[model samples]
Target: MRTLKKVGFSLISIILFALLSYVVLDFLVPKSNSSSSENEEIAQQQSRVFLDLVAVGDSLTEGVGDSTQRGGYVPLVADMLRTNPNVKNVQTANYGHAGDTSSQLMNLLEENEEAQADLKEANIITLTVGGNDLIRNFRQVGLNGSVEDFETTIQEYEENLNSIFSLLNQYNDEASIYIYGLYNPYHYYFAEFEGLQAVFDLWNERTVEIAENTDNVTFVEIDSLFNPSDAPTETEVESNSGDSLEDIQDTNHPYLFEDDLFHPNDSGYKVMASALREAIEKELEDTDSLLSMNR
Candidate 1:
């Protein structure tokens, strides 16, 4: 009877110790299932990709030239990104205004609440500036004007551009900026005016330098697209308008320019949109490559 009681006590003690140990371990250690679920949730969140594009610049961005009067390249880009399999969601905002210069853009960015919000949420940004800056100056001092005259303006533009970039980076460091290089509407009309082209080249070179130096910035070239090898025939120009050659120079490009000859027509907007899409596709590919390498 004593031996049996001792055996029974030993068995009960072992069971109690086992139960106590299980309780202690359950209290001390995290649950593996819950931990795994949380990790999965975090991973899923990390894997999701959203694209929000914010366009801030001049009339071209405002869809002024587009006969359809849609949202210009902003809507086109948004649509493209939405169709992209990698992008889970896409949003876009356009802050373009006619006759807006780099200085104006800087001021708007600093003061505009809506621009600030859009920029803060932007994953991509586009700019079209320096056209009005140069063109307005050209009107003030004809094509023969000395480069010295532009020195002050160029310096101010550079400062404004730097401030713009700084503000954008402050708002969202990851946002990619695509700045459209100025195209010479006067290329056909002023082909002989080497100084005019020279000015454009210099300005574009500086803009390219800025973009190259900045992170996530790209200079989109549209000069060649506007200035094709085969110039528009006299008949084409005459048919469109009876205006003199010089007067029609701006409005000559049937494909690219709107009736005003300055802003991009719908087709012109498409060209810009295509260029942006290509850049974005390249960026996505590069990202994918990096991710694969990481994996």
Candidate 2:
């Protein structure tokens, strides 16, 4: 009987020891995993920076012509930024309405709470305005939209843009604002219109002036990119009886979307993205920061 009792006690003790050992190992393993996870997070934070990029303006920013449904150059730019070794992640917000003009964008800036919040958090801003403003004026007045007509329109546009810049500065003064210059989408269709090119030039010039005067504002020129080397002159358009304007456009403007010839296709957006990326890289170098200014 005494022998039996000893055996029972020994078995109970062995079971208890096993349970205790299991408990200790479970606690230690979790602690080890937690420490490793924490170390990894710290390392990631040290090695990479995150950026919030906000793109605001018209159809160009909205990605109207892109079949992929991604917001045009905005996503392309974000993708490029992601490839940078220093950039860990990029959060992008696109507030591009197809028919929105500068004034409309101002209204959106004033009214939209979510956009306001994103703007406040933005490390960089890409703006594509003035094009719709010009387009709207031309539509309202027809071919009568001359340089003189555009002067008044441009003054209003400048006022609205200044308000926009002021609002953007107020939202996040540290953000670098990159605004695109106007390209004459009408130059091909209205090849006979004498003052059309001059109007686009004036608009772009005023836009450059505005950007120059604003703090941390950079003007990105895209007008020249759309002008194809094979584009015909006024005489060619008038003489080319073999091909229609649509055919000529199809042949000449490969970067333009076939559906509406106004907005850019995928390749065009790529070029714009490339231009934007170059500007951002240059800014980063100038400021002596990483790919994006961590604000």
Among all candidates shown, the one with the greatest lDDT: 2
In order, candidate lDDTs are 0.79, 0.84
C-alpha-based local distance difference test score of model 2: 0.84
Model 2, 226-263: lDDT tens digits are: 77557765347547757665556546456678788788
- Please count the clashing residue pairs in each candidate, in the order shown: 0, 0
What residue runs in model 2 are displaced by over 4 Å at the alpha carbon? 1-48, 228-241, 246-252, 287-292
Worst 10 residues of 2 by lDDT: 283-292
Best by TM-score: 2
What are the root-mean-square deviations of the candidates from the true structure over C-alphas?
7.9, 8.5
Tell me how far candidate 1 lies from the true structure as C-alpha RMSD in angstroms: 7.9
Model 1 scores worst on lDDT over the 10 consecutive residues at 286-295
TM-score of 2: 0.78
